[model samples]
Target: MAAESGKIDPMHQFLVEPLFGQHLVVGGYDISFTNSALWMVLTLGVLWVFMLGGMKRELVPGRWQAAVESLTGFVGNMMDANIGPKGKAFTPYVFSLFMFILFANILGMLPIGVVGLHAFTVTSHLTVTGVLAVLSFSIVLIVGFAKHKLHFFSLFVPHGTPVVMIPLIFLVELLSFLVRPFSLGLRLFVAMTAGHILLKVLAGFVINGLNAGPGIAAIVSIPSFVLMIGITLLELLVCAIQAYVFALLTSLYLNDAINLH
Candidate 1:
């Protein structure tokens, strides 16, 4: 039974598989629609339906409309708190980012495998998260330069650094600033991947224990099954927390650009 479970490849789930036999190439780029892309489309479609729930304009909102308002209001308040008065203008972008990531993360946790469909966690991929991090950072750079011009360079130097230490401090601050995107992307990718790998390994254990014997099932499979349930709940909480952390950090970074503090 251990051998049987050992044959299960935990990492195989992360593999990007193409849905179609045919391929599309443009400028030497393989733009083929993959399982990852299909899930992203599903994520977007679900999110769109969720948003439409709020369009009733009723004086008293039902549960679905209330949920929509709650999320939007939460994101809006986060921006106001993080970026201050000027944050209102960027609310749309930040809100979109928060919802997309939240939905993507949650969608991956759905119990789709029971229906002969495997859910792909898009956030587990570096390319997707890196693009999001870069896009956020790019906006910061654009806003900083557009508003402050060369004065944006002042961001690297502290307001009261001693003359002798200014150079060292500037270098450290610059390095930290430059690493934001890499760290942001890496954090989410590592987190999502680790959680999924752990869950898959636990599942393998359950399967193996059941097949090994009734004794092994009582000793291992039942416990493993219970543990999987607990971890699943924890992962769901983590999904929301990570999404909030990413959005909050982005807002803070934008504050630096907007206020140059």
Candidate 2:
């Protein structure tokens, strides 16, 4: 049974099969297609359709237009609430980040089995999350330096500390800043990865129990199906919350950089 289970390897259900090999033998550079890339493209395509469909100016709004407007308004409000008046200039960056993340997350929830291909949750990967965090960090660093020049380094210093306490406070502040990217990436990756793994394990139990016997299986399957439904709904909420948290933290970081407080 263990061997059979190993052969089945439920985790391999999300593995990406390469579509291309190394272009130059010496360089060993390979460009391969991946499930994550497919989902990202799908998300971008969906976003393009929605945004384009709603681009027309009309006296009365259609459903797509309403959705676009609502999403825009929500992001706008979030920027206002989090970053204040200075955030107005950051609206484009924040909105783009929110939409990309939101769509990537929503696309992960689709039932890809019907399409005869396994779906990988892109956000579950530390590499993907790390890239996003690093991008946000770069934006903060660049914008801060551009705006304040050398004075931006003052972010590491606190205003109200005694001379003796300044070193300790500065050390704490510097460490906190250094950990931002790791924390941001890990939080999203862990949440999505854990949720998907839990769902997969529960699903395996359901499948195994159903193969046991009709009477016992039926009793077990009922609760399994109910749990699956509950988990699916929870996953939907998790997707949104993770994206919002990421964008919210990013806005906060940007605010910190701009205001230096």
Candidate 3:
């Protein structure tokens, strides 16, 4: 039905268009405000609002407090389990990253279209996720070099490798280590992008079916709608899992820096 009139572009949702028809250039770089940036700020605002909910600090926790504490505690435990005693100092960073990514992801899945609003997922872009991955990798490098100096290079070598095999092992490990940021960023971006594309295509089916009238609506739209709901639920789970995976990988990377193992 939709194809009769026009084809829906699944990639349309991922386009980062400038907002308000305003463009600015700073140092030859396009610094114009974009829909992606807007959603990121909104994500932060939403996160801030939630954080404020737990500021009551009651002796007995309320719903908001429990929700906030649960998230914080989950990240705390993850850091502890992954990095041990040294991980305690890094809990704040891990918690912030986890919360930000989680909220950003969850916000993208909001049914804003019901109110004629558009939803954009920042994590769906490699640029955003790549920056995050690089940030984590940068911190690991800084900490590693600061603590161990020249010995930091040993991170590429296995503990029990024979001297002759050390060269090959080190090269392999080095390549793998270098690929971490790319892999990390690409994982989240790909997952979010693919899921959103699938959802968008299904949504097109729903709209087209409805527009085609009752017969097509019942046949095409209804099943697509039901499947969309299931996929949306799965996407929500993916949101949490992706966030956790990112934070977990960061902690494990930090573990190498702090513990040198």
Candidate 4:
């Protein structure tokens, strides 16, 4: 019965399929190139093109050059606002992080022509997002320890509290600190997953209803198609928002590490 249903599974698109002939396992780990890896490479390629092309020096800046400058300035301002002067040192990392995420998202939204192993969203997977989150968290931890040494542990203890509540406060802060990575990763993963699922279900209704339902069903699908278009547009905005939010939070964490409360 389940096989006969032929329903569209939104999750099917998020599957990480190996791009090579077969899955390659070295030692106990699978490091084979996957659709997600392909997309990540493609994302980097897109950044390379923008960065390289934007290098033109002319009296009047071209579109690509202007775009590149604008994006750089925007992120620079965000860093300055969040992390202050020290943020300049981390601009490259933050800029690259923002661009990688933004491009990854934009690529996934593109209506590229390819089947099976194409058009995967890296951020849709918790593994990918988790890695990014951990990288950000590690940066914060390392910076905190390097700058303050044993005093870094003070971040988990509130500056001022009653003597009796100190233990409870420390426990609460420790739990909150530990959950940062999971929260960051889950935010992106869940948002991408939910938006894609809604879009897929709406599209499936339009396709399946038209092909396999009564005349009334065909009529009902018209609105579904319209809603699908609207949702696609919203998802585009969401892609940018999620990337910005991630980068913003990373900068905030850096700021906290640099000037602990």
Give the TM-score of each candidate. Answer: 0.95, 0.91, 0.95, 0.91
Clashes of 3: 0
Specify the highest-lDDT model's number.
3
lDDT of 2 by residue, 1-261 (tens): 111652334465455545353232345654566556777788889888988898776789888888899888898999898889999899888888888887887777777756665566778888889999999999999989999999987898888778888888889998999899999999998898888777776666677777777886788866887898899999999999998999899999998888998
The pairs that clash in candidate 4 are none
* Cα lDDT for residue 223, candidate 1: 94
What is candidate 4's CA lDDT for residue 180? 93
Model 1 stretches astray by more than 4 angstroms: 1-6, 21-23
Task: Report how far residue 86 has shifted in candidate 3, in Å.
Answer: 0.9
Give the alpha carbon lDDT tens digit for every residue of 8-87 in model 3. 88888888988988688889999899999999999999999999988788999999999999998899899999899889
Q: What's model 2's lDDT at 58?
A: 72
Q: Which ranges of candidate 2 are over 4 A from the true structure?
A: 1-8, 19-26
lDDT of 4 by residue, 168-258 (tens): 9989998999899999989988998898778777867876778777784658688898898899999999999999998998898898898
Clashes within 3 Å, all models in order = 0, 0, 0, 0
In candidate 1, the residue pairs with backbone N, CA or C atoms under 3 Å apart (3 or more residues apart, or in different chains) clash, namely: none
What's the distance in Å from true for residue 11, model 2? 2.2
Candidate 2 lDDT? 0.81
True-structure lDDT of candidate 4: 0.85
Clashing pairs for model 2 are: none
What lDDT does the true structure give each of the candidates? 0.89, 0.81, 0.93, 0.85
Measured on C-alpha atoms, candidate 3 has an lDDT of 0.93
